[model samples]
Target: MLLSRKAWEIDLREARKMRHSEVLGCCPHDCQDGCSWVAHVEDGKVTKVVGSKEHPFTRGVLCAKVNDYQTRTYAPDRLLHPLRRTGAKGSGEFERISWDKAIREIAFEFGNIINDWGSEALMPLHDMGSAGALQRRALMRLFHHIGASRLHGSLCGQSGNAVAAEGHPISFDPETLAESECILLWGANLLSTAHHHWHFCLEARKMRGAKIISIDPRRTRTAAKCDEHISIRPGTDAVLAAGMANVLVEEGLADFEYARSAADDLDACLEEIKAWTPDHVCEVTGVAPDDVVRIARIYGAARPGTLRVGIGPQQSRFGDVFVKSLSALAILSGHWRLPGGGLSIEGYPTFDNAAPECPELSPEGTRSLHRGQLGRILTSSDLDPPIKGLMIWGHNPLVNQIDAETVRQGLCRDDLFTVVIEQFMTDTARHADIVLPSTTQLEHFDVQGSWGHCYVGLNHPAIPPLGESKPHTEILRFLAKEMGLDEPALFADDETIARSCLPDGFDWATLNQQGWLFAPQPRRDPASMGGSLKMSMGLDGPEDLNVRDPIAIGKLRLLTVKPHYLLNSTFANMPRQAGQQGNPTLEMHPADAKSLGLQDGDRVLAQNGKGTLAAMLRVTDAVLTGTTVLEGKFWWTANEDGSPVSNRLANSNWTEGGQPTFNDIFVEVTATSGFADI
Candidate 1:
């Protein structure tokens, strides 16, 4: 209430004054390119935004999304107050409620669910929405104390992290890429996906003459800018990677001694790749055998070639397998030791030490959930009484999940009580039993680190939380206290949580002033280099070769791929962004389109066994025949009577590691006449 009073006073002042200086802070959204922006406030209103020149990561640059902050921050459709559904579930009908009543209602329902079904039935789904470390960790601590069903393995980087853990000691620093002679932009588009990295890539090109080779199914902005683009079939990255390793071995381009030393079972691994010759791989990946060999040779011979592995390569059914194979290419080529010559996987560097202290919920014991199967978890009676209570934060499962219709059904279930904390009335929020207003990055203070860049940024609050919105940390703290959780210490302030993340003896004041933290250099020893090769290569063995089972036949293999623009549906609700790109549509190759009697821009019914969706067709050669590509950010919308559109294409039974593989589903497409343009 005090904050609101202050905000009102600021607003009144803004009406009297045209402009006023407001210190800028970093916007720590679930984006690879964390932007630095300064707010112009007159009274209490934000009148303008500009790039922060002092911010090292952004370097005074702001993306289109950041430039449109006014629309996103104070949009008419924003959840200005808490709301409880008054109409039937999924009806987009809600009545405004005060924060006091909202929180009390949520607590009462959640407590009742816990009392009746036990903690395991109450599932807390947390992702990148409120990325503040204290906020996320507090939820984990609360769930731990209350015995809630915990979400595990990470919907985003489980496979990539597994590869990084198994293969390298640390990711190749982005700064080192500028020194490379050659760079492989593997399965990722840095220009659109990781915008901040694009600046570095451009510098590497201009300064170091770094030759860029982009390997992806679509000709993205990065692909268009690269020196060469090798378009390959989706889900065949592993075969191509293995083929490269084979070429390195056969042409004597590999450091045989180093391979043997790095990996304990180097000889066995080499032998395993013998079957991955260019010809064999070409058959599977649809890439020419000679072209594969040529690319491999270029990569192997290039002095200090950097391999930047993108997250898209690891989104398939065999995501972990592909990541591991790619890592092997780097090791076999002996690229790991040189600067800018290693794998780079995208992820947020969380300082949360919950893993080291809480071994039960640590990274080691984390379970992998199928990001696509969110709907089934909510709706299925077979899930042992089903998840009774749900808490949605950071992520919008309705838009990001593979088969969205199923998720809608699950959310609409009478038995499933849902609470969504969000900035806007997202598709997922519309189905929630209660929706709580959440603060934007501009309203919170925290530190952020990028997987691409090494610099850690400090996010200072630039404006008061808008309307009735609350920072996620405060929400979790209040919940913890109300629930009487055992470890109240876990719900500490952002400053305390930030301090805990740093290594002991670090100067907090200096770090805040600098607005960035560089990871400490790993102590290097010449003695350690001798066994590095052996340690790296020792994992390859005959048994390890057959660890993964062969891909099943006859079933439709759906791969829910991310496009360059939207990565996991974060920017879907931004009006300016949505206006530019419109709603996400499905893309298929011309040959496949004709075979299915679908035309470009035609409304087609796309269905797997579980569900179907009607989407506008985008016919292009960019996608390979028989494979369909759809943008991953379309919120499931209902018909006039309330039947959801986007959810129609989801498969309920298709799950992997307790998560659904939306991308691994086999679907059939046909032109639909009655559908409206999506």
Candidate 2:
């Protein structure tokens, strides 16, 4: 058979294989897919990194963004040594510095900052950069040991996780979705952001014959591929859920038996939901009256349908309350009893407490800083003692954080001595006073657990450090020694730390042998759910759902849609990832585009006063007529002159959880004076 032309063009490599060994490790990115990956190592170098075919849930497939991470780790721009900044912030200029010198200088500066303004002045900004169980929270111990200021707020999945935790003892198991006869992907674009879970969703469709319904303002890939897509108004999720409850109770379709026991406060919840008629729901949510009845009928008709709520809808003012209302609606419809039927919140099982914890490091009475408000914390004069020094890890603030301009200004502060531990010269790293080279997951030895799937795995060193780079844990240990910290926990090696995180009799070798060990899966119905369902106030109906003008009324509500390839800003700097993303474009309904006197490909200015971003217009009716869609997370660092920058237009406001309200805003999109190709 002739080789396919496409296959023939594939670039082939012929690395000399001295000895090949399969090594297992887990992904360290802050993505929903927790992949148990396999590294094919030969001669102390990794030849290939692919998903572990043995991983039951992930089924050995990696997303487009992460599949080529081996190349990214070895990219020419990859940081290999510690460096001191030699140019203006964001200028990306640095001079190499020895590890000892860098550590000593950073420690000295940190001590001075602490001596002058107390430990609270020295802030550490870290996230799941390596997400290695050993590395994830390693810096916290150092910061806590030093009595640094505490960082608080729902920056990660905290907002959604908080609401779910209040009601459930354990997280709802997503694996049960395969048993679902009808699946509603609420606000989640699973195909793009959570690809691994999409497989089970497909089983619900092709195998179980489940009807899939997607509700969002834009025509996301997941929505476009689903059986039905509904365009709902932003922040009106509670209204739709409450309306569904009204219909379920009015038509006697609610699971009365399940509601009576599982949700004792059902009557009180119904009392509030009784006011939300289909018409009222339509008036508040952009969903039509008939669509509401149709969804309610389909959902109620199922023995117990499943509701998998996405984090996308939980970044608004009433995000927490919306979760509560959605929970009530699920119980009212008896959706929690089936294996694959229930509300799947953000959660993963535990194996010796996989999350990073250094609670002892938190000093009593320390001021708490919200991670999302980094901009405000840095720029606001009202701060009692402004942040004098900053240490960043894993996360890229210049692109991920809101108020891009504020972050830029804050990082530019001559007085703010910032140190960033990074694998590359990220947009955020460029703003640092001293940039420390950090190892990729391939060069780290640590334990890691998945928040998406039930798998606890280990990340063994697949290769030696490329340069003078070190793991976050090692760096923290070095700093602890430099600062004369006697805390034993502060200097634990990866093996010791990883071992401490597991329980007795845990098979340490299974992590590397099979690549993963399954944790105790979530129960179909747990008693802990009662507390949340019982304590929830009556559902918020149309009257309660009405959002007053958030400063103005006529402008279209804005939403950011993550491009299929670039899940976030992580791979934006990678050449291949950037090429796949192409130019940034803002999708608008044809009517909205016409209202702004713009056409397809026309450049438009989308500004909310706090920031101004520009993008080419894609005039399609895929989005709501009164809303615009900006695809993100944009490569702000790779932006060319006149290129679209989505974050520049974000309002930079904080949600109740302290996470940036990336959505939940309104903006005026006006035609630009001249068109420029992005």
| CA shift of 389, model 2, Å | 1.7
Per-candidate local distance difference test: 0.66, 0.76
Compared with the true structure, the alpha-carbon lDDT of candidate 2 equals 0.76
Q: For residues 466-489, could you state the per-residue lDDT of candidate 1 as single tens digits?
A: 899987778877776666655645
Instruction: State how far residue 559 of model 2 sits from its true place (Å).
Output: 0.9
Location of the lowest summed lDDT over 10 successive residues in candidate 1: 542-551
Clashing pairs in 2: 133-447, 144-361, 154-657, 167-532, 176-340
- TM-score of candidate 1 versus the correct structure, residues matched by position: 0.86
After superposition on all C-alphas, the RMSD of every candidate to the true structure, in Å, is 6.2, 4.9
| lDDT of candidate 1 at residue 455, scale 0 to 100 | 54
Return the TM-score for candidate 2, rounded to 2 decimals.
0.92
> Which residue runs does candidate 2 get wrong by more than 4 Å?
1-17, 352-355, 521-526, 529-532, 535-552, 673-678
Task: List where candidate 1 sits over 4 angstroms from the true fold.
Answer: 1-19, 167-170, 347-350, 353-373, 379-386, 484-486, 520-567, 638-660, 676-678
Residues 251-305 of candidate 2: C-alpha lDDT, one tens digit per residue = 9898777777776666677678877899988888868999999999888887668
